[model samples]
Target: MTAPDLEQRADHIVEQIDRFVADGKRVVLSSSFQTQSLPLLHLVSRSRGVTVYFLDTGYHFPETLEFRDQVTEQLGLDVVSLHSATTKAAQVGPHGHLLFAEDPDYCCYLNKTAPMETVAAASDIWISGVRRDQSETRRQLDEFVVRSDGTTRYHPMLDWTEPMIADYQERHDLPRHPLDDRGYVSIGCAPCTRNIPGSDRGGRWFGMEKTECGLHVDLVR
Candidate 1:
């Protein structure tokens, strides 16, 4: 998309957000604090009372934590950090290895998805940075979707491509995640992520068949 096109989309997003706020709907945003997350982070910063939630799964790279803190401080974002109720030591399997090695889905549920469920249940709108160009699963998502629990999953940047994201980040002079320079495009937990050569979400979940960590699919009712 061209710069003018992106600008138009951004304007529409602002209007939509304003309408939601006007309706007195509780608005919340969840971010993974990656480079791709910057555009939405910056956009939502313009709106007041939009609390950004970061699920601290206790498995993120040190750089990711630093990046989250950096962006929150720089943008003055009202970020709330959520952590799993389960202790890291208790995330182990019967064999004493991490549950991610045995059952990644269950591991994600306990760590990432479960912690966000309560917040999503109470909020009227949940803004996401999920882009169509990121993954096959995300490509099927619409700009606005009401989940089973009545919380609307809003994807304002759903149509944005890789180039558009890069252009926007450059235009805003955004601070990138430290791992972005090393080809970690779609970052997640350190053990599940890898250095893929492209901008898409191929780096996430690595060799596993799973794509999403279940925030988009299972976090709602």
Candidate 2:
């Protein structure tokens, strides 16, 4: 009943099911299980069409892994986990620590974007719970568009404000991220993330100029 008649707050995703889902749609809800995405996942579970995809970057917070299972169990969502075709020694050093300190872009390419590319080739439309309020890059994203890999990106939550997402999640009794109260609205890799007072991770990648994870790194390409 969230979008029975379909309204502006709906972001037009359910209305465009044709593009998001085919005979065997292969539609994936690319989620970090971030709070902004909770509403989208809730919508997908009730729809009975799309499958949720979670990229196991190997560096996610421990709580994130736990919440991932909890949501899957609670939502009754059939989740597909994607992982990089690399090993720990390949991503990190021989010491088994991440190499993000030396090369953040390559790190992301291997961890987040690389695995997603493999699994998402199952369909043209990859629905993400991306919101413009989350980052500067997202602010310019369209509701629907093609990516550099010839895959169409669907951002159902593009126009949603943070408060709107929060309100809807609460109304629906959706599960908030276990760490949301800790000021990690835009949670990411464990090492790269930290808490900021009254912040939704505007401080993420703070010391660096990087805000995105190379998911759309082709803006310059």
| Alpha-carbon RMSD, each predicted model | 1.9, 3.1
Q: After superposition, how far is residue 102 of candidate 1 from its true place, in Å?
A: 1.4
TM-score of each: 0.94, 0.87
The candidate that wins on lDDT is: 1
Alpha-carbon runs more than 4 Å astray in model 1: 218-221
Provide the lowest-lDDT 10-residue window in model 1.
Answer: 212-221
Q: Candidate 2 residues 34-152, lDDT tens each?
A: 76778888777766677788888888888999999999999999887788888767777545567787677788888888888786675766888777786677777787777666777
lDDT (CA) for every model shown? 0.87, 0.75
- In model 2, where is the ten-residue run with the lowest total lDDT? 1-10
Q: Which pairs of residues clash in candidate 2, taking residues 3 or more apart in a chain or in different chains?
A: none
lDDT value, residue 11 of candidate 2: 36
User: Per-residue lDDT tens digits of candidate 1, residues 110-191?
Assistant: 9888998889999999998888777677778887888878999888888888888889899889999998778777888999
lDDT of 1 at 162: 81
